[model samples]
Target: MSDDLTTLHDDGVLEIPISLESAGNSLDGDSIRNGTDALHEVMRGHRKARAVLLVGKGKNFCAGGNVAHFGGADDRRQFLRGLAHDLNTFTDALYATQLPTAAAVSGWAAGAGMSLALHADFAVGEPGTRLRPAYPGIGLSPDGGMSWLLPRIVGLGRARTILMRDEVLNAQTALDLALLSELVDADQVYTRAREIAADLANGPTGAYAAIRRLLMTTYSNTLSEHVIAEADAIADLSITGEGVEGVNAFLAKRAPDFPSARN
Candidate 1:
């Protein structure tokens, strides 16, 4: 755990909770940079985690960007550049990670905060939680991969309606719109996400990574290119220790032990 308020707990499952002193519990420069760095450290490097469960502390999962720090100055530009670099690095690392990721939202997730939650493989929000896009309200556009991910999750028309209107979508509506995978009780947000992460961690790591890669590359790959990629992925997975264990475990009717291997 870091003194900045973000807590990382390991209890048979890895849990990363975002707690900040900014609006909507959103991450500011210090919070985002420090928390992202700390997560890489705790996970023992980028993409090393078997699974990740992202949660929020207190009431809101996140409210969005910290407007208090927004200003125009040389110092501000430098800060903004550094912040963008670090965040993009962290986000890219997370996206490239070999593990399954889940977001557990408790209350309000607006603006960039909602974008962060949407990045997860599975998004779980409480019934009373609110999901909104507040960028247009502030005369700004989307960031934090929101522009790319929003349209993919919800169609272009629906995404435009949400972002343009800056409307608040409740948990059930978000679920109906495919913004969330499940609607859970507020109290069970973290617990349920942890369980989901644990389930993924217990599965085949290499195969999971291949699946993630496939999904990520789908948008850019041509039909012929995708076929080649699929073949490459299958061939790559067949040689890993995980592939061997997967087959053995199935034949033996026993659980596989995917202990960490140091090269």
Candidate 2:
């Protein structure tokens, strides 16, 4: 990964810092590509990361794309296309990862930044955090799965209003709309996210992955198909070490020690 994006693996948590000094940790081509690469490495089992945490290094979590790059590019169309492709790749990797993911937001999460925050299974933000679509503000359409994720998160009516009106949401408003998973103090955002991730990491990692897969496929699958999928998933997980430990632990009235911790 590039210096702008740093990854730290500790205690089964993969911490990724989206850092961009000039743009306040905004999304850029290099950062997206590098960050995606890092996630790919983790998924390949290069590191035993049971959970992932995305946090910003500076004031704002992410200000979104570097708008200046658009104006300066000799071929704006090609530049934008490539940038979107890279971002899609990153988001795809994030969604496909087996590890549970969380985002810690302290300030602005605008445009694609907001999408990245929403992409996480869990998003924790402080009172000062602000979220905006930012696409309509710049006369551009949505990218980074904003169009798909927003409505699912906040409902179609609210999502339409927020995107069309270029509405900026405060932390409380976002939380009320179900855009944020949790709220914390500015200084405690990352700590709180890490705590949540650690708890997930200690649980059944395989079961967590299965849950994510099932949920992601639910919207598209028919009722009969979905039930069968669920049955298959549970049957497959039953033989995993973590599953066995969980069953035994419950019978024994003790905490389960998942085997993934030693990986």
Candidate 3:
């Protein structure tokens, strides 16, 4: 049902577009399920893809929930609540994945879309890209991990101002706040993102996964605990074929061939 929502490329980049035919490219239950399932396949080794890339299919990256559907639901409360749950589940799945991830935010990344971008390890945007807390505009609190991700990426004070004021940040401001890793030409957003994903896919997969996990949990750990976690990570990775190959390559003054390294 959702096969079309994701495409795993031969270069090992899994591309998950924000939406299908949904209006404004807003997320739906089907799209969310499809995307999450795709990620699971990759993480479980059912698929060969080693990196994930989120892209937009239409004019806007995503405009948050389908507002018209919300207004027309027979049981608005139930329908809305279920939608939020599905979105949360999908966002959690995306965050939990160990693979490197990037998002090509070519156009407007409002509300849930903004949160989705924040989930990625890197976000490539265009000069005209815009972001907004579209949830408050609809009289709703944030969802799709927005509340948690914003404060981490942009400072607590900036995040508070952006969410409370519902400020629509332009590309420059978003980049300045570190919301966007870099900006490319509007036409090259996806291409550049794909290049990044492919490049990362060829590097040390296990090391990337370890770094991602450690970085995400650093805030929750004490100084000693975090140091031990970092130590454990290095100790574990040092025995992996990737670590051996990396060190050998560095000593030999050659690039590491992680894929060919023995597991």
RMSD values for the candidates in order, in angstroms, are 3.0, 1.9, 1.7
Please provide, for model 3 over 23-128, each residue's C-alpha lDDT reduced to its tens digit, 9 standing for 90 to 100: 6677655777888888777668788877888887886777777888899999999998898888887777776677899999977898888889888888999998
Each candidate structure's TM-score, on Cα atoms with residue i matched to residue i, is: 0.85, 0.94, 0.95
Judged by TM-score, which candidate is best? 3
For residues 1-263, write the lDDT of model 2, one tens digit per residue: 22446555566777776546566677756667777887788788776668888877687888888888898999999999988998899888877677888888879999988988888888999999999999998899999999998888778998999999999999999889878898998999988998988887777888889998898787899999999999999998887888888888889999889954233
> Least lDDT summed over 10 consecutive residues: which range in candidate 1?
5-14
- TM-score of model 1 relative to the true fold? 0.85
Pitting candidate 1 against candidate 2, the one with the higher TM-score is 2
Candidate 3 runs further than 4 Å off: none
Query: What pairs collide in candidate 2?
Result: none
User: What lDDT would candidate 2 get against the real structure?
Assistant: 0.83
What is the RMSD of candidate 2?
1.9
lDDT of each: 0.73, 0.83, 0.85
Report the lDDT tens digits of candidate 1 across residue range 55-158. Answer: 67668888876666666445876765665676676677566555677888888888777887887888888888898888888788777788888888888998
* Residue 255 displacement (Å), model 3: 0.4
Top lDDT hit:
3
